[model samples]
Target: MSHILLCFTCFESFRLTARNRAVRLSSVGKIAEKPVIGILGGIGSGKSTIAAEFAKLGCKVIDADKIAHELLEEPPVRKKVVSLFGQAVLDSSGKIDRRKIAEVVFADDRMLASLNRIIHPLVLKRTQELIEQYRRQNQVKAIVLDMPLLVEVGWHKRCDKLIFVDCEQKIRQERAEKMGFDKKQIKIRENFQISLDNKASLADNTIENNSDFSAIAKQVTGIFSYIVDNG
Candidate 1:
């Protein structure tokens, strides 16, 4: 047998290329090996609950909110945030003061937009990394992107399918209150989100989440099954 030595970098590149080709071929099949389902909803619309239901069904849910929360603790992200919003937004330990930042941005549209401009790209990058990692392990049959601004930020384009979690405004308000959000703050936050009608119009499927958890879970399970069967 002829002895062959390959450089580490070359071997790594070859391995990555092979994996990429496999992923590409699987993606092109009628049933995409891994489908990415984007979940969109306005504030307090039970998006997390819907995501949890999908998670229970074995879907890898990469929640943008959760990722954003993690980013708050990242030193680079924290530094940039402090630079933009000032040191006042930092806590005693130099970590981000999320409450202060939230209060400021929610009250100012321009400020909120500026914050998103900084954070969204980072969030998307992290989201893609998580997606690829899940795919590498073959643990994700489908990935759920639970993003509140999925429609507003045009993330819908990145999704294979979009699901809108919906509920009446009153119900949303009630839920927000129970979650410890002040009524006024909830209203202010709601004002920042796009209209439910617009989100619903863009959705491939809509799950009405006003009633019972099981009702919502049933809808999610059905939709997930449909995607896996037909994606």
Candidate 2:
């Protein structure tokens, strides 16, 4: 009986050791992998265009806004949002009415914070899962996280390098209007976000998107080269 007890103890110890070793190996593997680059910009700042340019150069691009759209469809997220914002925010299909919610929260700081509190965690969780999935696939050397609220929500910590897309407010406003956004709505959305100067200050690099597409593409390519060389 004593011999059997000793053997069981030894087996348990060995199992724990194996688990620890596996965790260490996994962590080391992640450390050796390429760092992710994050791009931050305000609304109508052409962040998607910049991300597309990087994607064209064979870089993996993860758009956080796209992820947020997907998360809104998740049942758990939908339920939580309805609970917080009331049934009026939901459509007949039971999905959150994005425009309605935006109108309510964008004008009020407390409401916006409450909404973000519910959504941001889910978004971050999904983003991390995708990053891990891509890392396991090992198909891409780096990822570009096109997040509009990167600095606002303090998501910058997830990035190894940060780039801010800078554009004049007048140009951004004109672009927003051309995209069919109501002038008042554009102004309201712009008010909710941090200033461009503040975002640029936090970023490791800045790309001005007020110029032509070719000029913006050149800036993106140069930034990518710098990250690859320095990373």
Candidate 3:
């Protein structure tokens, strides 16, 4: 099969099982009018902060990380996860320990892909639902996707515009460190993703987040206005 066909096939095969509350991705509706913006950035590049800035401007943000966290709490999902990673990934209360899962996945590419295969389809289904809901709302100006693997999984094609959050490596490392990730851990996570340069090149816009919040707010406002006015 061709690359595109193979990609779809891979995604299709990863759909959540019936017992796990399957979400049929093929049935999700696309938003028709307002721009669907996707954020691209390296680890710790403040993509969520950028999405929050857009939220303040009336855009609905579809946060994949939040959705994933919620999904892991579902009993079916927890069972499936245990089957994949074993009970060792669970905490004392039998809740999935995100930190333990991260440790397992980040150290091995195959394990990471396996975990994503189980989660990505569900996230996409919920994301599309939110997008359709926001599209119908008069109060929503646009939709912002703050997904970590936006470009990696080809969701950038679903976006009306892509914004690359640019920040220095030093600053990014410092931020990641503050989030409990060391330099080695950060590098390992990034190693599995597309390079920062390639992600920036694929973007329609770039927002430098090397400075204060005011600067980011100013840039976000300008870009939001431009997308709304021009579209």
Candidate 4:
């Protein structure tokens, strides 16, 4: 459980699920034009911030979690989510109350997997389409996959380089609290993903995010440089 607290670090615990990489084909030509960098870290590790910093340095980020959030709002996906989780997950505005769903699913592994069963496929499909589109159009020079479960979902295979954002456990808990999650809730969120050790080991580079903003920013730049130079 402590490892779950240390790793996975998912703010929304139930978002962990995946299939193998060979399932989808990548267009070499599109991504070939530019390297695709995948960001990996536990939830609340400020991974999105690192990804954003890269964007500031001029990287086209394909934010998987952002795309997943948008998918929940679509009528077709919304209807499916409601059907599976029940109308209780819907708010007065008829929107999917993500927190409500998270509370229900995160408590039970089966329920968590069930929700993943529905969401992961759709998210993956949409993500692949976007990747293909971006590749086909040759629009972006560099691509960053800002996915929370990048490794779990096997999307890491597509990455030319992987960057792991390492943050202190205490700081991560605070970030989770800021996001409205209690300690237990934060633990629940982290339960679904792989270990931090393994995640960091898989990284081509590691960015320690526990210090000053400028220090973190400098590391982010270094990673960008490494990726660009090696890419």
TM-score of 1: 0.81
C-alpha lDDT values of all predictions: 0.71, 0.69, 0.77, 0.72
- For 39-118, candidate 4 gives per-residue lDDT tens digits of 88877798878888887876777877666677788998888888888999888998988778777777777776777777
Which of the two, 3 or 4, has more TM-score?
3
Instruction: Give the Cα error of residue 105 in candidate 4, in Å.
Output: 0.8
lDDT of model 4, residue 106: 74
User: Could you estimate the TM-score for every candidate?
Assistant: 0.81, 0.78, 0.85, 0.83
Winner on lDDT (1 vs 2): 1
**Per-model tally of clashing residue pairs:** 0, 0, 0, 2
Candidate 3 accuracy as lDDT? 0.77
**Model 2, span 30-84: residue lDDT tens:** 3235667778777678877888898887678877767777777788888888888
Poorly placed runs, candidate 2 (over 4 Å): 1-32, 92-94
Q: What tens digits encode model 3's per-residue C-alpha lDDT throughout 53-126?
A: 99999999998878888888898888888999999989999898888888887776677678878877887899
lDDT of 2 at 8: 5
Clashes of 1: 0
